[model samples]
Target: MAQSPGDGPKRVAIIGSSGGNLHSHGGDDPARLLADIARQLDAAGIELAAVQFVAAQSSMDHASDDTAATLWTLEPAGPAPTAQGSLSEVNETAGEHDERLAQSLRSGEIDGLILVSADPSGTNGKAVAAAAEVRAPASGTGGTSLATAQALGVDLVAGSGTTGTTSATRAVSYVSGLARRWGLKYRPVIGSGPSTVAEGSPWRRISIRGIMVGSIPAFIAMALVLAISKIPGLDFLSPVFDTLMEGLPIVVAAVAARRVSGLGEVGLVAGAVAGILSAQGGILGGLVGGVLAGVLASYLLTWTLAHRFPATTANIVTGGLAGLLGGLVVHFALAPLTSAIGDGVKTGIEALVEFNPLLAGAVAGLVMWPAIIGGVYHAVILPLVLVEMGEKGHSFFGAIDMVGLVMVSLGITLANVVLPRSSGERALAASGAAVNFGFGTFVEAAYPFLFADKRVFAGALLSAAAGGALVGWTGSEATAYLPAFVPPFIATNKLGMALAMVVACACAFAVTALANLHHRRKQRA
Candidate 1:
């Protein structure tokens, strides 16, 4: 038996033999063969309590009618087991044997169980069923099985007895790996017994929804700021809007941290720290600061709770202290690091525009589709675009935005209407078209079509590049920094905007519809 480093003792049982006659240089002795297998497992860091051998009835030869034959038995010379007369007899006893195995596992007498088979078909139908039944709900531990049969629950390693020692080695390795996964999934919390908390850590259980919810406030703020900017006499409120816009990253960061940590107090602290950092380093700073603060706060909170602090005050005191310390650290230490980053981004964008505005516009258009899909367009990229917009009346990014939100979406919608597709898809296309044309928000409806097919994405990219190039070549500008759905015509003259839109829509429609038609034809052929 071998003890794994950093892990407590684990009792394991192996059922089934390598099969065939036990062979070694010394000669054939089943006990020696079993000992050899156990030694191999020990060398591979597997601790084994016992090995049970199940020999097929067909493989055995009866000596005489009066002699009691030993067909199956435990290793290290245990009492000879009664031989089953037939396959049906073995199957009949499987249920009772499986129940006993399950009881041993539940009672913690056996920490792990391995079912080895000399037959590649996995012992027999009856035996496999018996192994599977051990993982049933009635056996306790929910449906968590000791074996990986059915691709559900914990995975058990299986190997063929025919493959010899190599297969046996693999089985040992698999058992070791399974034990490691089990420990990770069921590790006890610090300062708490194993009986207190269920399997899996809090951090491991966090969902994507938590992260998305954090970004909601920032998204809403973006829409509201742009919408308000369109109102007359609101020009005086530009400073206020700019402040909120700059602080949006902090809000996003805080919310995200809160969601991930599942601690409202910690989230608020993180938001405050991120907001302070963002004020100095801009949007990038806010994002980094929020993550750092949230992580630090979470650890502090966990420590406080684990120490048996009064439940009522633990969250507030620990969270507050962590936030205060984290905010101070970020403001004094990390804030200066991000200032250089912000400055470098502004400088880089300016240099790109100066070098080749047309090329820059085209590239921005090409990349915007992926950015939109990744949520970066709204979170990080769009804010940078706004920075450029504030300096100049418009940005090359705006052209890409215009093409992506309006023309590309419209083209895709048209393709859906013209091509053969499901009624559900057509309806979605119609809805997207309506939203883009009516409300000027293509994001809601456009994403589905863009992501539905690779051809659609390619069409959108080409269309965006064309529109972006046109905008750049014409030196078209937009006065208002609105969402992508708003046409460039609002800021630039109608003629250039219209020409770009026409080119974009045409390219997108032709590419998408033709690709779809070609696919359909190929399928038919």
Candidate 2:
């Protein structure tokens, strides 16, 4: 049953039917579909309470493993939705199980439900009846659920050929709309989706977003500790700030390892040990060591499991050995190689800035988004930025990024807020703009618009190039992550930096507004 507006967070359950099978449609797997639903619900300010697997048979063996796996994947996205623990016994008949589920829903134990079943005929009649009894929306991959939804007059049903994702999206949209109509209060969260690279890439498990997210705590701790220590009475806290900053590598390593290995406490311990040993090589070294250790540990665990080794023994030995080996490898071999490469890249960038600041800035700015799109930003650019920050107090290249990339992205998002064709787009753009301005570390808020149209992408590049050129000509550098507007005040050439920001932002805003206008007109036609 639906809760009233004053009720706390609305709880939802995902019911995956045992006999049903959801196949990959258009390169999106079932797990991805589930994750997408979670993201959309997060955006809609709804709570995904739990995922329940139901089987008609009187045995647990009939439950869908696919659904269980999907739940596992959703864990890393944010908070893991609870699994139904008080479900009926495996020996219970289908009718008994359905009754228990219905009791939960009817009693407001579960506020809403999303039913996923690929086969039209496979949806449990009892479950459908239960949802109908509560006037809950029915959504799925086939006509059976569609008929139920149509009868409910919800218009939230996906077509017969539609994927589970399509159904989930429509259902979430309807719920969100209903909430809005009822004047219900729900706060939308940003960055609820897992910040993972696409599947199939070896490093797909190495969430670049996770790395950045994990560093936030350390950054905050340092900021607070440093600020407090500056007080005359609290000067002793200064060393605490240094110690906290030094622990950042360990934090990053543990996060990276967990994202990659998914191994519980063992992974964290291994990653921390590997990270501490490789700290001499810098944060990059810790990251590399952690990832390497995670990979080896995962492989070893897999092998041990196949050989019938004890789980505890296998995990301990593999984790310990992997950490030591990974740390040693980085310290002895990769450290020197990475240091030399970092120096060389730094030298090349310096020479480019020296030769022609304007051209260098333009080139850097122009390629920023492209490199991000091509996945080079994570593998190449970020490491170099870290290198520069470690050696010099400020980074010239990073300065261009602020003026060109960050500012341009902000400009495009701000334009969307002014001239968005849809309320959803406008709201998202507004949020994106706020987040971008606040963090200045991420530009993902602009991704929807950038990926939606090539014109926007091109406009962003050109705008960023203009800004980068100005930054180069002025020789401004940035030392910290702050709003794009704030960089100029701290820059060597404040006036030039300001000019560059204005030009880039203005150009991007104009280009995006024009592109949006064209798109809106095209849609009307």
Candidate 3:
């Protein structure tokens, strides 16, 4: 029965279908699915006002403007109202024309909307905005759709047929519960809230500066560790340095998270959990664990504080519980999962290196450029190289990897110097050159140029690959962790190292120069 608009029960509309065939199941047909959804709504004492079926399409962007067909609309009469046409045309004919579908939502006819799509993109920002405009609560089932809904400040609910029969039933119940709670004002529980800081805002810039400041301690520790390892008879301090390296990740994570969250204690605990996870799983694991821990701690603390408990007792209890839960989960579950993944990666690298060191080195070098840019090489791959170095007393892979990075940085610096766009650019390039040659950390300087010009990046990548391959082919190794660009080759073949560096520098310089020249000519034209 159609419930009156002013009735206590909420009025809702279901849009889209599951976009999957039921395979002779009773719920296979679109009409059946809509009926089932309506029944669910009825059970919850919510009135199902309408069902809008949008034609299935691989890409939502390609869906026809007239694609939506109103299959059913509730009425007090004998038969439900039905309409067949392009959704755009139907809306246009109604004399309430608006360019975006969201404009229709401003009518405030529906109290709640359920968007059921197989994919998230099926329900675009327009639909979400419309829901928001009317202050109508909305929910979605699919991951993409749900994510979109969340990002756009809509409530989320599970959908049917995706997981299993049991899950489908649970999803229905979940939505019903939400329907029961419709009287309450809806606010997104997850994601960045309204009044988000803009990307270029001074606050965001300050956060970036904070991150850089926080990183300095870890950087100094690493450099100290590397320098100490190179000195003869300083091997006794290796464990201390290794401990520093391991602990520094936690400190950095804590400081960064604290700065971002403005929750110092919770951020520290989260960072500690992440550091431990990282030690177990590597960089990627640590990052995941840290983020999870931070969010968990923040939420728990916020929830606890909201109840007006004694401040000291509440903090201790909430903070302790949050840390315990986060630490346990990461240590017991996430650690093992990340460890397994790391093992698989290590196995792959070993197999490839055994098959052909030169090919493996070249491939690794090629891959490293992207990995470095993506910030994965340091977190995941570098640890494996370091482990191999420890086991074998030296690592050909390490030598090639380090040398390739150094050479590429040098190449980028030289490019800027040779083809200065401005006096400021030239000065910046010179500074980068100093860092690359003196400190062996060129990432800060090189990234700007690499991202600015595709041709220059390509040149650097190719050069690095060639250098890596040559180093591997020659079986070069390094006994201690030393800057690839520095003197005193340690246990490595100095001659081979020198040759590889020369080749890498020459290739990088030549390619970058040509690309710069081309760019200049294009500018002139």
Most TM-score-accurate candidate: 2
Ranking by TM-score: 2, 1, 3
Query: lDDT order of candidates, best first?
Result: 2, 3, 1
As for candidate 2, its clashing pairs are none
Off by over 4 Å in 3: 1-224, 245-262, 273-289, 332-334, 367-401, 415-428, 442-458, 474-499, 510-525
Query: Roughly what TM-score does model 3 have, to 2 decimal places?
Result: 0.47
Worst 10 residues of 2 by lDDT: 65-74
TM-score of each: 0.51, 0.52, 0.47
Error of 3 at 7 (Å): 29
RMSD in Å for model 1: 18.4
In candidate 3, position 160 carries an lDDT of: 30
Model 3: per-residue Cα lDDT at residue 28: 32
Clashing pairs in 1: 148-156
lDDT of each: 0.51, 0.61, 0.54
Candidate 1: global Cα-lDDT?
0.51
List model 2 lDDT by residue over 411-464, tens digit each. 999999999856689988988888767767567778999989899989999998
Candidate 3 lDDT score relative to the true structure? 0.54
